[model samples]
Target: MSRERVSFTELTDVSQKYWPEASVGVSLIAPAIYRLHEYLNRLARELFKQYNLQSAEFETLCALRNSPEPYRITPTELYRKLLVSSGGMTKILLRLEDKELIERPANLADARSRLVALTPKGKSLIEKVTAQLIEQEAELVARIDQPGQLEQHLLRWLAQIESHQDDKGPHL
Candidate 1:
């Protein structure tokens, strides 16, 4: 069976009919955000493909790229930040290392662990990809003509969610 794309208005209407007491906030915003997330994920997959990169590899590069200058972090930190298992991080690091996109150097502070550093080539690649990705993402908000306002709203909502999550204790 094919799933037809339903308009937001129709969805809300049908949802209300099914559950008269359904909260509009959940019915509307959750679905809207979910649909947008699906679209963005597809867009990101296509963009990552053009760079011949897997999602985890690209994300690992990003985590390194966004870190303090010299762009290095311990593998443990990388796995924690990415929420992947140690074994998973090892595989990702190995693949990235083969591409010369990252280098693992012995951590002077810790003999037991090595630091993951972004290579100059990796920096260049990530920067190029980020620029293109931002350009493409901008199109999604172009019609809104109030990207800043939208971002502020999202930030507030995110902070609230994060705060609630924090109350539950450490994520991993």
Candidate 2:
């Protein structure tokens, strides 16, 4: 008995409609990764807009909620965690502070340093949004049948890849 060979068409039928003429080598892996990343990021942006927050602001709020002790993190810590430059982090902090969602405190340990923390209202907002975000994420990730396994696999794949880089260099 002989088995038939499967063509690329069979593996990537749906993708061809939009990315027709894509090279076999590039199309197979790169497009899928790009599309999935794009879609998820778009969805996150939409969700953040619903809360009158941008993606960066939402992330900072959530990060504060997850922090140790006083639920505050220094500007340096936040910039490091968010993988943004000091100026970029400053902009985000100013925007969130304008919304009264966070507080800036003079760090006792270092007078020149400032720490950012979520306000009570910020905590409340995150608690509410987190539940909603989790539900949305669950629905999105449910598209993957075995999410736990898929998540693990994706994390391992990402870890094996080089660090995310920008035009400047390897992102911190």
Candidate 3:
């Protein structure tokens, strides 16, 4: 026997009976994006756990690894790059320092600011973990393929959205 298909409207009506007060104005895009974000976070958390690391630690390592010449960054710089609050960055740095995974050095630029850099041991560990993480990430993306192309398309979409930011502000 063939089953009859239920349209979205039918599902919405059925949902109201069970949900009672759920707004019908909900859009699929928001929920789908949220689910995708959660899925990626879970996968990342699992992968990082294999190295005894977290996403925040991995990001800090990458930042240090990518730094030019001196291979160091200030807490303020790290905070800006990671989009984390100052207090949160300080806690992260403290944790990494406790692990001896990174070092805090006197900043030549300004005495008030301290510079953060990977220790020799930290560098070795980051190199090892990063190699494994890269392979894992590649595998994850391979399931979908053309991740670079997808990233480019997403970048374009994001740029378009960002372009409209000023439109909401008051005109001069």
On lDDT, the candidate that comes out on top is 1
lDDT tens per residue, model 1, 1-172: 9687787778778878998677555646767888889888889899999999999998999999989999999998889999999999999999999999999999999898889999999999999998998899998879787889989999999888888886777561
* Best of the candidates, TM-score: 1
List candidate 2 segments past 4 Å from native: 1-22, 162-172
Candidate 2 lDDT by residue in tens digits, 1-172 = 9766454456577556666677445635665676677667877788778889988898889889999857898988988988889999999999999999999988999998889998998998988988887898788888878899988987887765645444436653
lDDT of 2 at 98: 95
**TM-score of model number 1:** 0.85
TM value for model 2: 0.77
Clashes of 2: 0
Q: Which pairs, if any, clash in model 3?
A: none
Of the two candidates 1 and 2, the one with more favorable lDDT, higher being better, is 1
lDDT of 2 at 109: 95
Q: Cα miss at 95, model 2 (Å)?
A: 1.0
Give the Cα lDDT of each candidate: 0.90, 0.82, 0.80
Instruction: Put the candidates in lDDT order, highest first.
Output: 1, 2, 3
| Clash tally for model 1 | 0
lDDT of 3: 0.80
The order of the candidates by TM-score, greatest first, is 1, 2, 3
- How accurate locally is residue 34 in candidate 1, as Cα lDDT from 0 to 100? 88
CA displacement after TM-score superposition, residue 56 of candidate 2 (Å): 1.0
